[model samples]
Target: HVHGHFFALLSGYIDKFQLSEEWHRFTGDSSITDVRKCYGEPRAALHEVCKYACKFSDLDDPKLWEFHQGVNGGRMFDPAGNLRGVLTGELDQDSLEGLSGPYRDWVATWLWLEKKYHLQAGPPPTMLPYV
Candidate 1:
């Protein structure tokens, strides 16, 4: 069911953002959990996404307030759309690997535009949450 969780995670984001990607339009016996197997991500690496969250936002601190706060959408989220904490596509370890030098440079340029424009992704955490 790990694959299902991952698909839930991805679809959670995709739907949350109204990403408008055709990849999500497929119809079949497919399950959201099968995304990794279908798209090819080592099953072991799936935990990477929430590793930091678990470490900092542990039982004592179930929510990583500071980390989410740093993610600003400038009051951009609304209850009607069901949007919440922002997602950083960059936190992926593979982000810069195998990319052209110029394109990589461009990505770096906008890495923190959220903080700069006062567009908090969700909320900022003053201290790392307990894992």
Candidate 2:
């Protein structure tokens, strides 16, 4: 069974992976193509097929506008400076490369939806000095 700590860790991941609001706005009008120009490439840009079962739960009671609220108790925000997305399930060394096509697009789409709805509400991370 998943532990409560797992959810907390997941939320932290999401936060770190999220793009700063400034970057979001700059690319807001830009098409996906434009985004590629500004942000280079995305890691695990596409969603991999669920070869095995994955888990999702409603942790924060997310609302339509309040995207962050629904964190689902994943606490996906990363504590590290760099960001990444976690792809769980029964993925292994070989299977990861094959799970392409719409699967990848799925992850990208979800990221877009999250940023569009619940952006950081400030300038880009580049501009923000470390605390």
In Å, residue 92's CA in model 2 sits off its true spot by: 7.9
Global Cα lDDT for candidate 1: 0.31
| All models, RMSD in angstroms | 19.2, 19.0
lDDT of each: 0.31, 0.28
List model 2 lDDT by residue over 43-93, tens digit each.
Answer: 222122221112232223354336555555776645332224545565434
Local lDDT at 57 for model 2: 21
Show the lowest summed lDDT stretch of 10 residues, model 2: 2-11
Looking at candidate 2, what is the lDDT of residue 92? 34
* Most accurate candidate by lDDT: 1
